[model samples]
Target: MTEEREPGFQEPIEYEEECENCEVRVAAICQSCGMPMNSAADYGGGNEDNNCCVHCCCEDGSLKSYEEVHQSMISLFMKTRGLDKERAEQAARDYMATMPAWIGR
Candidate 1:
């Protein structure tokens, strides 16, 4: 019998924070937007936010969602950050692929 293959992996959040009360929170520090989302569905469910919430939401933090990542954040970077349309997109894509967001201690 053929072996089953594993699904693609998405980077996990490096910087999640919560109150002493144990409330879950995503630290929304996009270097663009300051409002982080508390849940994964904040950023329309993609890599738009990456680290910062309300930017993107991973269905289950799976990295296979790269396309969703690119679509969600590309426009925002160029528009808000005044980055060149092409370069901003490339950078955002790169960040999503390589750099996992910083999680709180």
Candidate 2:
């Protein structure tokens, strides 16, 4: 018999096949930045095992500090989105607040 989910519940995506460049299976999104991590190249340090994206990790394959990620996101918003410093900071905070890594803090 098929199982039924609760109201407003969503099924988790299950990745069964291994990625071409790494042993880890593809995940739905980066836990840190919410970026799609469909391919090995899209994962941090090019490893599909990472829960975060390349931008959210250091070259050594560790997750970046919260401040570092916050600053980078602010800078990115200011540069690419043409937001001013204050607005960029707010935008970054709002975005990061929704991410798993920064949800409570």
Candidate 3:
């Protein structure tokens, strides 16, 4: 008897380098937290921040970076900083919303 192979079972592609999508930097993302790699590379310009980029090239066309501008604001709401989850989530949303299109910046 012959065995049949599955139709959609494909092997995953391994890359030597980190993903350049969300969280590109290894230091920015937390390990104990067990969260998915946050998308930091999508931003563009490298940063000591969330590993995303300082120059965020968002889908929408807007050239404005709030990463630094709102860094202090978000810091206050960080869960790791004794802040509530709600506060952290709110800050995350606000920061992402201000992300600008890093078109060759």
Candidate 4:
């Protein structure tokens, strides 16, 4: 039986070809911010092949520097969540640590 999803909800498109090898279905997500890339508009350069999101890309389609992305995330958290500078910075750092772009750094 088919299940019902809320309006505007799109099933995540798996980017990986070797689905059997993957323990979990890997959705197309922004390498920088971990945002799910549900549509072409969600990807950097409006290209589905891009690994990052539009927010994490420069006008020329290159990924932004780590510091630039870090600052943006911090500001977003501060503005949206009403978090203080220190808390926002820490939250951004923690969140970025899990993202593919910032995994090692």
Candidate 5:
């Protein structure tokens, strides 16, 4: 059996605004550094303009270049895993290749 509502009666709809830049609608980790941020100003390093976290930006809020982030990650990986420079670079390149273009080459 089915029940029907009045002709003019309609249920309300819900909507959520996600980040406009990184395409991440939900508050989550930074795409580059794994830091947490969202669209809120108080927490998660959220920035509504470019849709990125605070640490990922310069003082002016411009996003850091992809190469910078990639190099940092590679260095971190090398230091933590004890990988040689050549091996770390290749591994980092391979890993970044599987990520979205936003993560860079």
Candidate 6:
């Protein structure tokens, strides 16, 4: 059955696929938050472990809680991608909602 969408809900974004094994199958999305991870290799580069984007992990290579990850992801997307604040906020929420297993505490 087709589901109804909320008013003013934008469709999910389509991203490039230059990187391999991206979790979302989008070119430059972070596996954790499903946002763009377009920083240089030394800074948030993609890795074989789920191809998680650099920003998705801490400097020590630990994963952030879902809330923290999504918040940072939304902010980065807003500044780097010039996305609308409200839309980015919603996107962050939606992405987090889909991955409750990673959202510890």
- Regions of model 3 farther than 4 Å from truth: 1-80, 101-105
Better by TM-score, candidate 2 or 1: 2
- Which sections of candidate 1 miss by over 4 Å? 1-35, 39-55, 58-64, 101-105
Q: What TM-score against the true fold does each predicted structure earn?
A: 0.41, 0.70, 0.24, 0.72, 0.48, 0.45
Q: Give the CA lDDT, 0 to 100, for residue 15 in model 4.
A: 69
The CA root-mean-square deviation of candidate 1, after full C-alpha superposition on the true structure, stands at 9.5
Candidate 1 lDDT by residue in tens digits, 7-60? 332334345656678786655454223344445465434454464444444355
Please tell me which model should have the higher lDDT, number 2 or number 3: 2
Count of clashes in candidate 6 = 3
Alpha carbon lDDT at 53, candidate 6: 54
lDDT of 4 by residue, 1-105 (tens): 998644433443566434776675456878788787777787888877788888999865689999999999999999999999999999999888877677668
lDDT of 6 by residue, 23-92 (tens): 4444444545554544445224334333345666766556666767878868976998788989888877
The stretch of ten residues in a row with the least summed lDDT in candidate 1 is 96-105
Supply candidate 3's per-residue lDDT for 94: 51
Taking every candidate in turn, the Cα RMSD to the unseen true structure, in Å, is: 9.5, 7.1, 16.7, 11.4, 13.6, 9.0
Residue 62 in candidate 1, Cα distance off native in Å:
8.1
As for candidate 5, its clashing pairs are 37-44
Q: What is candidate 3's CA lDDT for residue 62?
A: 35
Tens digits of per-residue lDDT for model 3, 13-97: 2222367786654433211121223354433243223323333322342323545434544565574567666677676555444
lDDT of each: 0.51, 0.76, 0.38, 0.80, 0.55, 0.56
lDDT of 1 at 41: 60
Between prediction 1 and prediction 4, the one with superior TM-score is 4
Clashing pairs in 2: none
Q: What TM-score should be assigned to candidate 6?
A: 0.45
lDDT for model 6 = 0.56
Q: Pairing residues by index, what is the TM-score of model 2?
A: 0.70
Better of 2 and 5 by lDDT: 2
Sequence-dependent TM-score of model 1: 0.41
